[model samples]
Structure formats: C-alpha cells, structure tokens
Target: MTIFAPTTDSHEQQAPPAARRRRRRVGVMSIVMLAFVALCGYLVGGFLRFTEEVNLLAKPAAFAAADGIVVLTGGAWRIDHAIDLLKEGRGRRLLISGVNPDTSVDALARLTDTDRKWFDCCVDIDYAAQNTVGNAEIAGRWAREQGFRDLILVTSDYHMPRSLIEFDRVGNIRSVTPYAVRRDDLWRGDEMPSAPGLRVLASEYVKLVAARFLSTVGIVAKQSVSTRVADLAE
Candidate 1:
C-alpha cells in the first residue's frame, strides 16, 4: 500500500500570494476614495467661502436699526462693531454673550471703548455661553427678559449661517438681522489680499454642514412662546 502525506509548507507559501493580492486591491481602493473625498471637500469649502449670502452679513445696512444687538463672542471685531452700533443708536440694549468671567465689566468697557455705566445699564455681559449653541441659549434668555422682539445678530460673515440657525430656535423674535464682518481682504496699501490663515472660513464651513444635517432632522425647529417672558426664561 502506498500512502501520500500532505505537506503544510507549500500551503503556507501559497496563502501569502492570495493575501497579498487582496491587500493590494484594498490599498488601491482606499487611495482612490480618499482622493475623491478630498476633491469634493475642497469644492464645497470654496463655494461656501465665496457665496453672496455669506458675504452679505458684513454690510452695515444689514443691521441698520433693530430693537437690540446680540454680539456672539470669539472674534475681536465683533465686540468693537457692536459698540459702534450702540454708539450709533442701533438699539437700546446690547447683549455681549460668552464673556469671560475673570474679566470685569470695566475691562470690557475699556476694550469696547464704552463706559462702565453703559455696560451696567445697556449692556449685559453673559458669562455662561461657551459656544454658538450656548450663545443662543444665553442670549435668548436675556432677550426674552428685556422684551426685545427684533434683534440684530453680529458675527463673522462665514459664521452667519450657523448663527442664524441657532438664533432661529428662539421664537417670537421678529427679525434676526445678520451683521457679518468682512474677513476676505485686509488692505495693505492699494491692494486687497487674502488674509493669512483661513481658520474662520474652515471652521464655519464645518459648522454649516453640521447645521444643515441637524436642520434636516428637525433639531432646528422654531419653538413657540405663549409670552415672550416665558420662552426667554426657558
């Protein structure tokens, strides 16, 4: 009787070729998919950065006259612009939300070129909000308390879209006018050039995408307030 014994060595050697082929295919597909995604991201980012709606917020006429001005903190220009509007009589009350607790009102007044009395009476520094969502929450509460029906919302041009979504959640507000700061060009002599570091543009694009997704799921619903006081406090 003749019996043949199976060898493990040949099988082990052959197995590597199959595994290597599968790995190579997967690597190529991953590279292709990554390249496609990167191209799409760049296109979307550029479009959002240059859109008319995004650029309109910086116009002074956008918030010419409103019941109140709500300045979302983060950008240095936002506070300065809000103070200018206050000085120009844009509104009776100004809410500077997302203030640092460590900083005193007097310090803020100096930074904003307004007096402490003005901050004490007309301005309310909100220390609670730490993000855009928090800015809406805190500002909504204060606006309701002050009985402001119409509001002028101030932020960077790129940030206006997401800010609008957050502010819209507060009901009974007649109009949330967006006042965006121009960031694309900082003039140095006669030429206008792209500002170094497009951080705001990039960040706002991400937030805009997230807001769109959230809106689609109905998270950005307009809430109803029986009385302005009731909704603002809640």
Candidate 2:
C-alpha cells in the first residue's frame, strides 16, 4: 500500500471557503452595528437638545417691532397669534407663507373670523410654499424685494428653531423675532406624552438635525428657493 504524505499546502487548501466567508460577514456586521449605535446616540443627543430649546418658549418675553410678520401656516393657533400681533401693530406687513393654493383670502378671513379688510390691506398670502423650506425661500424673496430689514417669524414652538435657521440661510432679512404658538400641554412633564405628539417631536428633531447638516455642507446656501421649486416641478 502506497501512503501519501500530508503536505502543509494541502492542509491549508483544505480550509473551507465558507469559514472565511463567515468571518468576513461577522466583521461587516460588527461594523454595521457600531455605525448604527453611533447614529442612535447622535439622534438621542439631538432630540434632548431640541426639547430643551423648545421648552424655552414657555416663558416668552415681549417682542419688539419688525418690518414684516411671516407666519408659517400649520396650526390654526399660529395664524391667530400672528394676526393678533399684526393687529397689535407688531409689523407693517403680514405674510402668510405656505398658504394652500386652493385657499382664498376670504376663506382665511372666515376661519379666523377677521374682517376682509385685514387681508385686503395688510396680509399677503403666498401659495408658492409647500413646506417650511419653501416658506423660507418664498418669504425670504418677498422680504428682500419689499426691503424688509426685520421680520417676526411665527410657527409652532417645536418648529421655530428649524424655521429660523432656514430663514437665516437667506441672509436677506436682518433680524427675525421668533414667536412660538403655544400648544396646551404639548410638553407637560406631569403627563405621559401622546403617541402622536411624540412622533411629531421625533420627526421634527430629525428635520432639525438634517437642516443643520445641509446648512453646514453648503448645499442650502448655494441653492435659491425658486431654483429648488423649479427642479421639483421638473
């Protein structure tokens, strides 16, 4: 009987490719897990910071006058508060940005139970904006054209930070006084938050982080609002 000697090379060749593949997969999975953990940490940190910032609106001081008032339409209270400010002589012009295209001035007047004269005289509605980003761009352009140096920016408390950042990106308006619309029990520590409220807060936090990233990357700075809208249309 002829016995073949086992060589080192043969033993090495006998190692299963499947084992190597398994090792490689484990390495990739470990890297992915680490990345996921990092992202979660960042999001949690951002959410905490966002909550702190929004809470500051609980005790707002009296805001001085500005050249114009820009109310981003989302909640009914935001519109009402902005209108109250306008009637109080907070600003010379009131720009109701992000109005629904189908919504007429009369409809808004009816919703707020205001006189038609308010819309006819001081209020200007922009149907161009579809979101907060659009609101900033269209409103910024209007403010620039009208030579408004100062503007009061109104939105929900959670939304104010991101909106201010977007508006500031335009660099046209000299000053923006933020007026947050209070939502009753929005952040009451005494009670557990509703699912819907938590979801909204989480979403806004993500948006705030994204806006900051885009602002830092110079992407937001380079593109004009009209250009973005035209691109979206195409």
Candidate 3:
C-alpha cells in the first residue's frame, strides 16, 4: 500500500554552482559581443554621414571679409591661402595657429614669402596651439582680446567639420566661416594630389567623433609643450 502511493514535490532541482557560474559568464559574453557589434555599426554609419558632409564642404566659396582669420598648421597651402586672403583684405588680422615649437615667425614669414610689414602689423603667429582644440582655444582668446566677433577658419577640407565643432564649443565668436583647403591644392607640379584612401577618411572620422564626445564629457584635451615665438626677427 505504501509503494502504491506517489507524491510530487513542489521544489525543482537546482543547478550546480559551477553550472550557474558558467551560464552567467556566457550571458555576460553575449551581452559584450552585442555591444561591440552595435558600436561597430554606429561608427560605420557615422563615418558614411561624415564623408557625405565633408563632400559638401570640399570646395571653398567666396566669403565676405571677417574680423580675423585663423589658419591651423600641419599642412601646406593653408598658410599661403590664409595669407592671400589677408592680402585680399578678407580679414583685418591673420593668426597662424599651431606653429612648431622650434619655428620662429621670421622663419614662417620667409617660408610663406610674406611681407615683413604684414607679419608685424596684421599677422600674429600663435605658437601656443598644439592641436586643433588648442587652436580653437588660442584663436578664441586672440579673437576676444582683439574684440573680434567674426573669423575665417582655415584648415584641410576633411578637417573643416571638426574644426568648426571645436570653434562652436568655444562659444565666443559670433560668426565663423570655414575656408577648407582641399587636397588638390597640395600639389605644386604636374603631380596631382592623390585622393586619400578609406583608411585615412575613417581615421579622421573617428577623430571627429572623439573630439565631440570628449567635449560633451567636459574633458578638455591636454597640452604640455607649446611653441612660443619670442623672436620676431629673422
């Protein structure tokens, strides 16, 4: 009679601790994988949008004169173009930002073949800017000090969007017109400026994203050594 009776228990068997831990690890790994995939997709989409936006800004248009002009270093033709704009009376003052620490204004003047009077009177060499963020910060200070509300920003074509972003974050200048220096302008002789590969564009796009995120997080980029031009003489 006792053997005939069968009862069902309410509690189910629990998994072993090792098995539970394994399951948790697997879950965590899956979540991490999903997050990584999402991040990659986000970057890819953002890069495509960045490329499209950059294309629109590839060509420089005829712009009205501003209070000042700021040309970021690290490339050719940028200084030349900014100097030409200065000669054209596009801006009252030209600030050459991000000069090398070893460089002197006299050297820059000679390299650009600019008039000494222009360098002395209208052009200011900013050796303090170490990067693009530094460029914006230094340029903003210069603009504020000079009572300049409008400015012409000169940089590479692919770099224009990020440059504008940094300038806007400064929140000082009333107006900023970008003068994008395309790669085509880099060439001097019959040799042409080859189009940058995808890798280069992707690198720039990532930098643009990083710059935006860093600013949003209220993290100002660091600068240790900055160029100071004490000697105005060649």
At residue 79, give the lDDT of candidate 1: 90
Model 2 over residues 10-59: C-alpha lDDT tens digits? Answer: 86568698876787799999999999999899888878777777777644
For residue 225, model 2's alpha carbon misses the true position, in angstroms, by: 6.6
Q: What local distance difference test score does each model get?
A: 0.71, 0.79, 0.79
Error of 3 at 115 (Å): 2.8
lDDT of 1 by residue, 1-234 (tens): 998776776655667788868877999999999999998987686655545456555555633588889998787588998888888899988888776667777788788777777776678777766678777877777777778888888887667888888788777676888887666453223332245424555566676777777767877433322222222110
In model 2, where do residues sit more than 4 Å from their true spots?
Answer: 1-32, 189-193, 220-234
Q: Candidate 2, which ten residues in sequence have the lowest lDDT sum?
A: 225-234
True-structure RMSD, every candidate: 8.7, 6.6, 5.4
For candidate 1, the 10 contiguous residues with the lowest summed lDDT are 225-234
Indicate the TM-score of model 1: 0.69
| TM-score (all chains, Cα) for each model | 0.69, 0.78, 0.80
